[model samples]
Target: MKRNSLLLLWLFIFWSVLIWSAIDPKDYPTWFLEVFPALIGFVVLAATYRRFSLTPLVYLLILIHAIILMVGGHYTYAEVPLGEWMKEWFGLARNDYDKIGHFAQGFVPFMIAREIVIRNKVFKSRGWMHFFLLCFVMALSAFYELIEWWVALLSKEAAAAFLGTQGYVWDTQSDMFFALIGGLCAWVLLTKLHDRQLREL
Candidate 1:
C-alpha cells in the first residue's frame, strides 16, 4: 500500500478504537485526555512519514505505548483493572499500572529517538547519542513529574487521579528511576535490532 493510504488506515483505526472506548460506559473522563496526545503524535508522525519510515519494531513499540496510556486513562492508573488484579494476585499495596505507563513513556520514546538519530545520522558520536538519549528521557520523566505537581496544585480531585501515586511518598523518584532503567534497556535491546531494520529500509 502507498504510505498515505497506510497512514490513513492507521489513523482511522486509532480514532475508531478511541471513540469506541470513550463511549463505553466504564470509561473514565481521563481517557479522552489520553487520546489527545496520541492524536498529536499521529499528526506529527504522518507529516514526517514521507521523510522517514519507522522500523517495524519501532512501530510496534509506539502502539504498545499508546495502549499503555489508553489503559491507564481508562481506569485512572491507580485503579487499572489489570493492575488491580495483579495487586490482588501478588498481594501488593496498590496498583502499579501508572508505573508501566511512565516506563513506556521513557522506553518507547527512547527507541523513537534512536531511530531518528541513527536514520538521520544526527550526531557524529554514537556514544554521545546514547548518552543524550538517556538524559533526554530522564529529563522528560522529571518534567512530567513537575506537570503532575502543577496539576495537584491546581485541582485536588483531578490531581488524585492524575498522579496515580496511590499514597506512595517516593512515587516521583521511583517513576524517574524506572524511566532511567527503561531508557537503558531500550538502548541495549533495540540498538542492534534497529540497525538491522535500518539496513532493510
Candidate 2:
C-alpha cells in the first residue's frame, strides 16, 4: 500500500475502535483512564508523521496496543469476555486480562523507546541504551501502579475494575514484573526486526 493509503487505513481502524469503545462503555471514567494513553498515542503519531515517521512495524504494534486499550475500556479488564474464558478454561482464580495490558505496556513502549534512542543516537553504548530502556520501562510500570493507587484512593468503587487485582495481594508487584518481562521480550525478540525496519525508514 502507498504510505498515504496505509495511514488512512490505520486512522480508520483507530477511529472505529475509539468510537465503539466510547459507546456505552463499562464506565465512563474507567474507559477514559484506559483509553487516554491511546488518545495520546494518536496525537503523538499525528504530530510526528511528517517529521519523524515510524517504521511500519512500530505503527502496527501501536495500533495493536491501542486496540487492547480500547477493548479493555469497553469491558473493563476484570470483566473482558476473553479473560473470563481464559479464567474458566485454565481454572484460574481471576481474570488476567489486565496482565496482557501490562505486558503490552512494556512491549510496545520499549520498542518505541528503542527506536527513538537509536535514531537519535541518545546513547553511544549499546549496553547503556539497553540498561536505560529497561529502567525506563520499569519506571513507567511502577508509575502506572502509583496512578492506580491514587485513583483507588480517590474512587473506591472504580478501584477493583481499574486495577483488576481480583483479591491478589501481589498484583502491583506482578504487574511490574510482567512489564519487565515484556521489555526483555521486546529487546530480545524484536531488536533485529526493528533494526531492519528502521533502516528502511
Candidate 3:
C-alpha cells in the first residue's frame, strides 16, 4: 500500500481505539494516567511527520504500542481480561500485561533511537551505537518508572491501577530488566530489517 494510505489507516485505528478506551473506562483518572503516553506519542509523531518521518515498521510498532496502552487504560493493566487469562493459564502470580507494556517500552524506543543514530551519524562504531541505544532505552525505562512513582505519590486512588505492580516487590527493577531485554532483542532481531527500511527512506 502507499505510505499515505497506510498512515491514514494507522490514524483511523488509533482514534477508534482511543474513543473506545475513553468510554466508561474502569476509572477516568486511571485511564488518563495510562493513556497519556499514547496521546503524547501521537502528538509527537504528528508534529514530526514532515521533518522526521519514521519507517513503516516503526509506525506500525507505535500503533501496536498505543493499542496496548489504550487497552490497559480501558481495563487498568492489573485487571485486563487478557492478562487475567494469561495469569490463569500460566499459573503466574499477577497479570503480566504490564510487563508486556514495559517490554514494548524498550522495544519500540530502541528502533526510534537506532534510526536516529544511523540517520544522524551519531556514532562511528556499530558497537558504540548499540551500547548507546541500550543506554538510552534503559534511561527511558527508568524515567517512566519515576513518572509512575510520582503519579502514585500524587494520586492514591489511581496508584494501584497505574502502577500495575500487582504486589511484586521487584516491580521497578523487573520492569527495567524487561526493558533491557526487550532492547537487546530488538537489536538482535530488527537491526537488519530496520537498516533496510532506513536505506529505503
Candidate 4:
C-alpha cells in the first residue's frame, strides 16, 4: 500500500479502537491509566511525522502496540475476554494479557529506539547498539513498574486492574523479564528487515 494510505488506515484503526475502548470501560481511572501512553504516543507521532518520517514497519508496530493498550484499557488486562479464555484453557493462575502488553512495551519501544539510533548514526558498533537497546527497554519496563507501584499506593481500587499482578509473587520481575525477552526477540528477528527499511529511507 502507499505510505499515506497505510498511515491513514492506521490512524483510522487507532481512533476507532480508542472510541470503542472509551465506551463504558471497566472504570474511568483504570482505563485512563492504561491508555494514557497510547494517547501520548499519538501526539508524539503527529508532532514528529513530517520532521521524522519513520519506516512503515515501525509505524505499523506502533499502531499494533496502541491497539493492544486500548483493548487492555477497555477491559482491564485481568478481565479481557481473550485472556480469560486462555486462562481457562491453559488452567493458568491469571490472565496473561498484561504480560503481552509488557512484552510489547519492550518489543515496540526497542524498535523505535533502534531506528532512532541507527538513522541518527548514534552508535558505531552494532553490538553496542543492540546492547543499549535492550538496556533502554528494560529500564523503560522497570520505570513502568514503579509507576504502577506509585499508582497502587495512591489508589487501591485502581491499582489491581492497573497492576494486573493476579497474585503472582514476582509479577514485576516477570514483567521486566518478558520485556527483556521481547527486546531480544525483536533484535534477533527484525534487525535485518529494519536495516533494509532504514536503507530505503
TM-score of each: 0.88, 0.96, 0.98, 0.98
- Candidate 1's TM-score reads 0.88
lDDT of 3 by residue, 1-201 (tens): 999899899999999999999999999999999999999999999999999999999999899999999999999999999999999999999999999999999999999888888999999999999999999999999999999999989998889889998899999999999999999999999999999999999
Per-residue lDDT for 83-119 in model 1, tens only? 9888999998989887788789789989998888887
Reference-based TM-score, model 2: 0.96
Clashes of each: 0, 0, 0, 0
Off by over 4 Å in 1: 1-13, 25-29
Error of 2 at 115 (Å): 0.4
lDDT of each: 0.79, 0.93, 0.94, 0.95
TM-score: the better of candidates 1 and 3: 3
Model 2, 16-83: lDDT tens digits are 99999999999998999899999999999998899999998899989999999999999999999999
Task: Candidate 2: give the clashing pairs.
Answer: none
TM-score, candidate number 3 = 0.98
